[model samples]
Target: MGYGFAWHPVLLNSLLLLAAALLFNRLAGRRYPHSQPAAPAPTPSERVGVSRADLHAALAERGEVVDISEDDLEDILQRAEERSHQRRFGALRCADFMVSEVLSVSAAASSDKALALLRDHRFDALPVTSSDGRLLGEISLRELLAAAGMHPAPLVGQLMDTCPHTSRPDDPIERLIHPFADRGVAHSMVVDGEGRLLGLVAQGDLIAALFREQLERPA
Candidate 1:
């Protein structure tokens, strides 16, 4: 009985610490909400049977049934058509869909120029580059807040968290998703084996793909 009384304060302190940690995690998560963990995505094999291209072709066949079987084809296509065009599960493919048009800011370019581009372009991120476009660092709205001289004229070169994660045109997409799980980046620059920028794989792009697939499926 004496021992139990002596341990009361220690147990209470441990419970208090646990509650503090929970509160701290919630507050920190609000500041960096994108870092929150996501549900596991489905694999290519799961999505392979009804490819987007094939579905689009079905929907394009307006009133004419060329040489195809209408009943059988329409039945197969209806399942995908009724589903919400919103994305569900999937991985990203660099070559099949990543955007190749990557706009960049120059390190020597003034902060005003960077801010202007951020406003003008619809993109959520931009890579920084040399006069010749050397793929320096990148800038996003998160980094833009410091451009008011609140800090150094934060050079795009300095803001790049790290070199972009790139993949070959032929690299299996499942492998690519693994690196994205822990990175600070929300997009990956798709590149060739020679490291030439080809396109970008923004998180939105993957979500868009699923929507596209649904749209193309037959009703």
Candidate 2:
């Protein structure tokens, strides 16, 4: 009986070890499966077709174009997006559009002289500057005439606006949009870092520039 009991204990231990070995082998096979790693998900290709799709998606998001065909709209959006990127990076500065040959008059100049400058250039307003080219203010024909009607003095200083809007030559053209909208402002003076007159930006110039950009874009 003692021999039989000892044999039973030995058999039970051997069975337990066998079970553990089988379980470990099953787990290892699952972890390091025989199959090869899934062919890396096919990488997307870059092509003009993808670009066209992106362009269409952008136009659809705008929700403003209902009359144009898909092809035409894609072309327009692509060109517009290029220009937008240029403007965003400050490629077009105020100096690029400003008229550097500004026709201005001295604040000390007589109202008659100022009017003559305006008449010669057919300008509605002229920047009034010190003899040293420092911008003092702005004078308009309407203000000149109004001043003449109200007082005898014909000096431009008396007729000029003391607080005229000013901008820098390096400024982005977009900076003028709000000012242009708030006032029916047709022009703004471009000044140097020292507040000296550098050039002028007219609404007509901006409009012309936009037209030119559109024309020059790739069709």
Candidate 3:
């Protein structure tokens, strides 16, 4: 009358319960699988496809925009495009566009000699360099004219702008744009690490380089 080996039934029931649980878990997983959220769309700043029409439509959708006219907006866009172009071509160094065969007057040269060089070259200014080709200053037509009535014409060193604007050959060409525009800098002497004259960059040169870049840019 003892419970004669009832372990078999208990083991069978345990196995059945485990199987049922596993089957139910598999079914539940099939019915409700894990999912990932969809990615967000690219914003205007992230995508290059945002056009002027898109901007106008966006402004219209907001309703009753004020102050800025369409022309002003177009001008702004043009400026932005120009800035983008600059950034894209920022790798262009001063040495790339500078005129290597520059006509510089020696600092020891007389005022008359400096003026002659400027007039002969049809240049507004000329860089004054030392005998060893180091940049000392710049001489302009105005300086010579200012000393016109002097009993003795001053030397180029005396009349030159000692603190003239200068740029390193490795510098980005874009760095000179502001100086050319704001300070009326006609030429920037491109020097080396030891301040030796390497080349010259005129406003026209910069403008031509940038214009050429624009023309060669892909449509």
Candidate 4:
């Protein structure tokens, strides 16, 4: 009877330990999933082995490709060919598209005075210059508005974009397109041989020229 009693306690203890171990294993697994092995890192050589079908699959996973029919493609190409024929490469000049008259403010002009000009003309930006028409800088409407609330006379020289990018009049139409396309500048100053302001080339000028080429195409 004593041996049987001792054996009963030992068996019960063994059962309790087994139950506790199972519970611990379940809890540990749920709490620390990251303790498992990490996913494999991609190899650089993988890209070299990537096929065109794989590339298509990856892009497709991101978004669906918009399909255009063969007929549509042909029509677009026909229109493009016609525009190429219509472009008057020799006749086009900088003076034809440039805005000759521009409202340029002196570098010494106060922010308040500049604000007044913008209010009257509804212009968002103005070019800053010296009295001699020497280009100094450019200021935007947003900068002017911010200064207006402060009631301060910020000098145009201090606020204007001094190192403004520019282009030459004698340059080809590609000059205008490249800047607008690459740098996101809305307008470019057409400078003379001596860096004098000859005219202004805007996004509109390029658009008009491109459209004119298309419209004047031989039917």
Q: What TM-score does prediction 1 earn?
A: 0.48
lDDT by residue (tens digit), candidate 1, 120-149: 876666777666545566677767756566
For model 1, the run of ten residues with the poorest summed lDDT: 82-91
Displacement of residue 212 (Cα, Å) in model 4 is 1.1
lDDT of 3 by residue, 1-219 (tens): 346446567767888887787788788775323357686654433255344576789788989866888778755764576566577765667898999998888878889878877778888888888889999998889998787667677888888999888999877777776577655788888899899999999999889888887787778
Q: Top model by lDDT, which number?
A: 3
| Clashes (candidate 1) | 2
Model 4 earns a TM-score of 0.56
Better-scoring candidate (TM-score), 1 or 4: 4
Model 1: how far residue 83 lies from native, Å? 26
Weakest 10 consecutive residues, lDDT, candidate 2? 41-50
What is the alpha-carbon lDDT of model 4 when measured against the actual structure? Answer: 0.68
Q: What is the lDDT of residue 204 in candidate 3?
A: 91
**Residue 58 lDDT (model 1):** 64
lDDT of residue 197 for candidate 3: 91
The reply for model 2, stretches above 4 Å from the true place, is 1-90, 149-151
Q: Could you give the candidate ranking by TM-score, starting with the highest?
A: 3, 2, 4, 1
State the local distance difference test value for candidate 3. Answer: 0.78
Model 3 residue-pair collision total:
0
